[model samples]
Target: MKESIFHRLYDTYHQDVFQFLIYLVKNRSVAEDLSHEVYVRVLKSYDRFEGKSSEKTWLFAIAKNVAIDYFRKSSVRSSRTFDAFDWETNQLVSPTKSPDALVELNDDMQELLLALEKCTGDQKMVIVMRYFQELSIAETAEILNWTEGKVKTTQHRAIKHLRELLTNDTVKEAKSHESK
Candidate 1:
């Protein structure tokens, strides 16, 4: 039974979980490690799962906590005074996509990813779950331990922020090219 559950989770959620982690971390190797951690957590807690939420949301919840823990530990280790989860960095790195995916990612998509990096952690999480992962509002709320209303509000704010960021970037690029 345990083996079957393991197989089912691997078959169903492995890629989605990895993608979610990769989007958050902006690094392939780190996402893989986090994905593994999520799987381990689910397996350990499977028996205790009360079925109040769907398996997907439960898995995502584990992934979300794992990411928060990673950022916290990283911040502590680096002696950063600020909360890393909410810190915005202009030098935020782009997420690593497969070669095939890289070929498909255009300038707009790159800009969008950068804009996403500038968002607060809650905004980013809401966007990634609602848009990137194609999860419903309720699922996102369950995963984030928030209300559906909060999820909708965060997503709206995130989209508006992204639009502003992308528009400004575009204007700057156009001006630079004109100057050249």
Candidate 2:
């Protein structure tokens, strides 16, 4: 593959691919390795890419497959949980926010991530692609090899499940505070 073409592809889709893998595995190092593998596969198969879909869609499809393969190989150990990410101290900072506000925001983000962990694999994939990666429904369907209706249904169910989990968490926290 020509260096320019490869560079363009990397520049256009690398971050999206990395983010998708990170969301799937909840581990930055694993995600980075998978992202590199995706690029390797793309370079090998670039000539076979027919123009049936947009390049973005094609790239995402490749990424989704790579992540799936990683999951399959590590299924026995896949139950590993995400470490607590310090959102307030991460790059998503707001200087105007008070310390209390920053801590609240971090807590909320952590809660949402934890809630997402309870979803089934299919539901989690749709949720990450649709919301976290900000892909459109059509693009998500193409990447997942599902019908548009299936994508919509999966996203709806995932959102409902997440709401239930987060609500339960909130209730439990409230009860604990009351008991305190």
Predicted model with the maximum lDDT? 1
TM-score of each: 0.88, 0.82
Best by TM-score: 1
lDDT, candidates in the order shown:
0.80, 0.76
**How far in Å is the alpha carbon of 118 misplaced in model 2?**
0.8
Residue 31 displacement (Å), model 1: 0.7
Task: List model 1 lDDT by residue over 8-89, tens digit each.
Answer: 9889999999888877887778888989999888889999999999988999999999987777666665665664444322
lDDT of 1: 0.80
**Candidate 1 local lDDT, residue 56:** 87
lDDT tens readout by residue for model 2, 1-180: 367888999998898898777767766677789999999998988898888888898999998888766765554244355444332122211112232222444777767766776677778788888888999999999988889999999899889988999999899999999999
Location of the lowest summed lDDT over 10 successive residues in candidate 2? 87-96
